[model samples]
Target: MPSIARVPSVPAPGDAAELRARARGALLGLAVGDALGAPAENLKPSEIRARWGRITGYVTDRPSGTDDTEYAIFSGLLLARHGSALTPAHAEAAWHAWIADRAEGQFRGAGFSERGTLENLRRGLAAPISAQHRHAWSDGLAMRAAPFGVFAAGRPAEAARLVAIDGSVSHDGEGIYGGQAVAAGVAAAMAGAPPITVVASALAVVPDDSWTARSLRRAVAVAHRGERAVRSAVVIGGYPWTDLAPEAVALAFGAYAAADGDFKEAVLTAVNMGRDADTTAAVAGALAGATQGESAIPEEWAAPIGPARGSCLPSMAGHHVLDVADLLTPEVEEGVALVPGTDLEPATDLVRETDPLRHNAWPPPDPTVFVLAPDQDEVRP
Candidate 1:
């Protein structure tokens, strides 16, 4: 099992309190989007109403984000508790525990990318992590890159690079690039920057070697011109499972650009547009949640997005947006031991920090609680 060794989490230069607050905002942004966008995943405004009759509650299906947001949060919590990121190995160990216990870890049964990745990891197949796991390319990367951005606030390049490796574990091509772009945005948010700049920064890091990047650039270009959704998607070729990362990324960008910096509006716009509803929500959710903060999510729409605060769903990943941010506070940075494990000759491990395009990480992380199935006694609305 690949191992994520412990390393120092250096804070960006700023008033420590202010930095902590921004970190919280970024973290909250992910959860709120994951929750809010989830309910609107599959249906457009019309279909959503036709099917669910006016989606005022948390839409469990869409915001599910195939568990992207949850997994990202889970990684962060593990890092917070253990004080470093997980190597592929550590992540695998966590998965094994889940399988053994029927724990159904966070986003475990979501879809193709995760399923394939886990199977390969379980077999101890030591291959370099790359787009190979889900060779066809998928939206898995787009959803889970936010937490990495938050944790890697000061190192945008590092964040982008690291997330790409993470993405390769279950994604490839445009899918991996999507994770890179999203992580870039989160890093920008963590740095207390504007969304446009963050998104633009992300646009730059994605490789120019493919059509997805072109599509992403086109989407960004037209985001300000008009209703970016219809124009960008149709003109720029947005469609679910089309092997197009930019389309989804663009839709998210257009919604973000059109919504007057409102998290709710951005997510609503994406959900209302249709196709890849959940993944779109997952991507848009991570971006918007980073910008707007958890408070921006409506109370009425909050419940079905997933579980609420204080719930114990092992599969849901341990922390909600709120819990995640709280973990990054200025006060939380004291003697948390910047390292993750007991001891790895820091001298040797430190030198191996260059980010890999993918990972074949081993050693397996401790089991993570993907969702905490609620008990009947506490099932009140």
Candidate 2:
């Protein structure tokens, strides 16, 4: 556990260096907040305060992140590899190749939604069918959404679209909405949007009447009153599980709103609120970190974050968040579109020459041409 250090203010944005810093801050903050909030995950606020007085820093002697951080790294690597063309097929294949089919390591701690998705995949189910589980509305997707925001910097709609594609393999309904809100919020923050605009960006992506939207509105509405008030406004006290997407996303945004996007204050506010603490804090951390840039995080907190241990996903063992940040922060060329599985899209003439079907044919081709194709199934009649 590290002691709290003086937090720095956010610097001006608009350069590659600043983007990199914000990317680093977003991921490092997620890990830090995950580790900080792990011990308080499902406890009530009273229980958390009773156990650790106010919890200003890491509470355990050997603090480490949980499923939230590792899963975020997993999604980050997938996004880095595929970029804009990322599809549900790509995400599903990665889940099987990197996680579901593995047989070596212990399938340690993970959220119910992840376990459910893995079970469905092992049973030969595919997404979005694979996502039809009992806990489909869990915050599992939200926990791993920040990387999409990092990859689609300044493009909130693109971030929401990409994260939903990733979430289809594991979640649905409010779960998908929750992921969208977090990803959009981070994307706006990456572009140096103010806290109010960031929250608005999040709300704009989801349906206006959705559970996630409603809870988010309620939480932010009361955020000025503090964590207790925010918690009261959004949390469903009778619910047993604390990982509801609506509740968790609301709490996280509430914390961010309450602190006005200050990295340390936002993360701590989420942590102290108690229910689904790890995930709420992780989302809050990502938002605040993006808004404030990496320099805003306390050195004591950042120094302890390292390569993920892969307790939750063995394939992510040696990759660090900083490594992901580097992969996502490359310089963009002015008018060249980047392609997946390669560096850049080929010139128009080159594409036409290489791919005959890519260009428009002058006159309309025979309508029956497809009916005479050689590969058609033999017609016994």
Candidate 3:
């Protein structure tokens, strides 16, 4: 087992409300991005352009999140119940209880990674062995990683650790790295870190030599150049699956970096890039939202995002992102009055001080070719 860092203490009462709002922004932004990008998922950029012409807003008449939002809800509720003590066993059990053990009708909008995991579980396989399916490296884990960041608040390392625990039940290698990057980025954003710092926090958690890290570095390096450059830098051309963990995670972070943490631009950039649009946009939305807070999200964009309809996980039905945010945020004690001018302590006091980008070498190593998943006719939504 990897040595874990100390978990940060919960925020002070004055900061609690602020943290809660950011958490709400992170989760709500995820749902909004997921819905807005759903219509563009699996389509090529040209196809998306032909159909919706840049997807400035929802393309569908009644826009709603697909598997992305529901999976985040599933992870959020599980994190709420377990807190920082979550383990691989707990995650596996939850899969069995809330997913695999349920009737066939209950499993509706699950992505390939999830469906594969459920099948393996029903066949009596336990994780990380159960995670051996072909699509184990999909962006499924990355899509749900924001909740760990929301729960850990300013603690990026701890957030990464917790998300890895969650991912262990269904992902491996680049898949786990993808989730770690997203979680760490969101955690840094929650701490009010700048966009560069947030990206650095993401790079800190995973091996620098991994495909996910390499692609992320490439994407962020050219992010300022423009969205097209960033997408072209990271996307693996000719890969059949749009949900490749390394490519999607890089594109999402690149979008966030390109927009400088602006919620709308970050999500819209990701959505228009087209590959795994829902997951990438959801990740970008979560990072930007955590940084900017709920009020930063456009009112009209926020309006359509109601409680999740359990399109993917039936056990998560009727649970709104706000509800999960509230659950993840620690509440102030009753009757405890907050000092109006109380200076909130810096997060450095709670978390260990370490160079987040120690492993990031300038001019990232030459890109390495990886084995792509076997081409399948059905792409994950």
Itemize residue pairs with steric clashes in candidate 3.
Answer: none
lDDT of 3 by residue, 1-381 (tens): 222233333355668678888999999999999988888888888998898777898877788877789889888877765566677898988887777877633445377888888888899999899889998888999999999888777677878888999999899888999999999888888867789888988988898788888899998999998788888898777778888999999999999999999999999999999889999999999999998999999998999998777666766667788877876764656455322222222222111122111234321244211111110112111
The sequence of per-residue lDDT tens digits that candidate 2 reaches over residues 1-381 is 111111222222236578788898898889888988999999988898799879999878878888899899889877765667678998998888778887524544388999899999999999999999999999999999998887766777778889999999999999999999999898888878889888988998898888898999988988899998999888887779899999999999999999999999999999999989999999999999999989999998888788888888877776788777766665445543322222532222211222222135411242111010010000100
If both were scored by lDDT, which would come out higher, candidate 1 or candidate 2? Answer: 2
Select the stronger candidate by lDDT from 1 and 3. 3
Ranking of predictions according to lDDT = 2, 3, 1
Better of 2 and 3 by lDDT: 2
Model 1 worst lDDT run, 10 consecutive residues? 372-381
lDDT of 1 by residue, 84-159 (tens): 3446555444444433234454445465666776667666653345225643366666766776776665445656
Q: How many residue pairs clash in each candidate?
A: 40, 0, 0
* Alpha-carbon RMSD to native, per candidate: 11.0, 12.9, 12.4
lDDT of each: 0.53, 0.81, 0.80
Can you tell me which runs of candidate 1 are displaced by over 4 Å?
1-14, 44-46, 49-66, 81-86, 92-108, 127-136, 225-231, 234-244, 292-295, 299-318, 329-381
The numbered model that scores best in lDDT is 2
TM-score of each: 0.69, 0.84, 0.85
Badly placed stretches (over 4 Å) of model 2 are: 1-14, 104-109, 332-381
